[model samples]
Target: MVIQHGGRPEELRAAREECAEELGGEPTAPLADDAELSKFYDLQVEAYECLVANGYSPAPPSTREAFVASYYAGESWFAHQPAVPEGAPIPDTVCPQPMLADIEW
Candidate 1:
């Protein structure tokens, strides 16, 4: 909703909570397995390298193990840090999130 609606994080978060409440825990799923993690990490690294090549500044990515641990802890990690100059917009071609194929998202 934030991507389309352009709302504050707090508002978006509250909306998410409201939606979750309405669902009443109707859906649940298991975490990704090791093979899935390996595949995703590989793709993420490639995408991060591409972003860096395009002049997007990002810190070195965490080790796959560390990243998996953090992922399980619900921590968010961005390959590119948002350091856009004042009054500047990110280029449409510069994507922070990787597009994964042949894998369930």
Candidate 2:
């Protein structure tokens, strides 16, 4: 599943567990040990650094409860939004190669 936005660890872990339950299996171990998983993990670290460099996450941390509440509330709000009309424009960012390359993997 695509995690389109960011939130606290507790919420993220809970959602992953729920997804695993729906899939009829246990939540898989994180790729800390697997070679391919490690690559992506390193990439995420690089991505986060890039975000910080680009002024995306210099904000102070919120409490866990507040963070989870915000995620749930945001999801609820989005669910009630009207669908986009055809031909609407979308914006995206390319991952910063310099950030990824600077990371020690």
Candidate 3:
């Protein structure tokens, strides 16, 4: 869960706690850079593909927001075990707020 700066810290913390309860684990702190973020997306995509290959036919929502909503509802690919483990520790060198121009995409 990438928490953008829309809410107060306490609100964000509460939301994170609620999400952890729903998802069955706490989310890692936001990824430090586009590289890490890309890696995260890649891992998720890989997991989704693996689940599909294994006959887990998750119906991903058409829109990103819908996907996220489904995820929070425990009705998305996130509900299944991934082929790879989630939440490997990120190094400190990756900045929390990386400049978009510096990222390779």
Per-residue error (Å), model 3, residue 92: 28
Q: Quote model 3's TM-score.
A: 0.30
Local accuracy of candidate 3 as per-residue lDDT tens digits, 8-96? 89888877887788789854665344444344344455545555665554333234444444543555343143334563332223212
TM-score of 2: 0.28
Q: Each candidate's lDDT (Cα)?
A: 0.63, 0.42, 0.46
Off by over 4 Å in 2: 1-33, 58-105
After superposing candidate 1, which stretches have Cα over 4 Å from the reference?
A: 1-27, 82-92, 99-105
Residues forming the 10-long window of minimal summed lDDT in candidate 3: 91-100
In candidate 3, which residue pairs get closer than 3 Å at backbone N, Cα or C atoms, i.e. clash? none
Ranking by TM-score: 1, 3, 2
lDDT of 1 at 59: 58
Q: What lDDT tens digits, residue by residue, belong to model 2 across residues 16-100?
A: 7777877787746542324443343345445445555654532233333343345424431111112343423221164443222
Question: What's the TM-score of each model vs. the native?
Answer: 0.53, 0.28, 0.30
Model 1 lDDT at residue 19: 70
Q: RMSDs, each prediction? A: 6.9, 14.9, 14.8
